[model samples]
Target: MSKHAGVVLPNKFDYGYHAEFQRQCSMCIDDATIEGIVFDFSRVEYLDSAALGMMLMWQRRAAAANKKMMIKGAKGATAQILAMANMQRIFEYI
Candidate 1:
């Protein structure tokens, strides 16, 4: 069995694509029927300020829907970005 959730994010996230990413997250959150949301960062090589905002927005949306959120497979610069944002404290990283 897979631990990953159905909510999927893109391999690369930044300001230019924030709207699309937001839409995907909204679908998961507004559905309000998912057990959890997992952001698989294995392919995410770069992210930006908008990416941070997008994550925060998703976090809020998930909270509103009473869904747990998780992050996994963040490596290299992706890991550093998460650390720099201090997201490790707020999100469950596995």
Candidate 2:
């Protein structure tokens, strides 16, 4: 398995996407070889508070596993929302 794993987020990231996100997160987090996980928001045009909550949960899990967390391609409204939520403190933007 690769050292780095990532999930390309969908356009509408909300509660409905939780299962899929959890599935992918398990694959990445369970892999011992993985040192980092990236959340690619390039294609995500909108995200609700639920999505933010999910990300926070995952960030805590990742840290507990000694894995780094990164956020990629966040721009426009997505970027603004994240900034307002202060997500940058926990996730490195790549």
Candidate 3:
């Protein structure tokens, strides 16, 4: 089992990288070998609707694969945005 933790910005969260991340997560889930994913929002200053959509998509994927996705270290406006969007229900907030 493996664990990955970090904040992915839109610029770095391009389709290619996102796909790769998904693939990794899928593999982990399939094998029941991955512990989980922890997304740290300490440095995330901005997030577009697309990013939010991507997160929701990922949440679904994780659920289908029987894996867990968690968000942590969010503060300030970032936390507010997530709350406003009701992302807390989609992604486990820590």
Candidate 4:
């Protein structure tokens, strides 16, 4: 089975929401046999350093598990943020 899962980042992804984000990611990763993760950022208006860090962490975890990690629906400011962080190269954006 392909372990493909997706998470829609809340409109506001900030420090306070870190734990929830982590929990969601972890749950998806742990529950799936395959390691494919797709983080849907279509709804996110702004992302801070913490969000970036969380993304990186999830990416690494997925990589370690030999899973494909991707980012989808990133546009506007969110797209710029990922681009600035050089995460565009690491994630597949759709």
Most lDDT-accurate candidate: 2
Q: Taking the tens digit of each residue's C-alpha lDDT, what string does model 4 give over 1-94?
A: 5557888888988787888888887887787575677888889998899988888888888787677788898889988888999997888875
Q: Estimate candidate 3's alpha-carbon lDDT, on a 0 to 1 scale.
A: 0.67
Worst 10 residues of 2 by lDDT: 1-10
> Per model, how many backbone clashes are there?
0, 0, 0, 0
Looking at model 2, residue 67 earns an lDDT score of 93
For every candidate, C-alpha RMSD to the true structure in Å: 2.4, 1.6, 3.5, 1.5
Q: Per-residue lDDT tens digits of candidate 2, residues 11-83?
A: 9999999999999998899999999999999999999999999999998999999998899999999999999
How do all the candidates rank in terms of lDDT, highest first? 2, 4, 1, 3
Candidate 1 at residue 68, lDDT?
A: 73
lDDT tens digits by residue: candidate 1, 43-76: 8888888888888888887887787778888899
Residue 2 miss distance in model 1 (angstroms): 11
Q: Which candidate is the best by TM-score?
A: 2
lDDT (Cα atoms) of all candidates against the true structure: 0.77, 0.94, 0.67, 0.83
Query: What's the alpha carbon RMSD for model 2?
Result: 1.6
Q: Evaluate residue 49 in candidate 4 and report its C-alpha lDDT on the 0 to 100 scale.
A: 96
What TM-score would you give candidate 2 relative to the actual structure? 0.96
> Candidate 1, residue 48: CA error in Å?
0.7
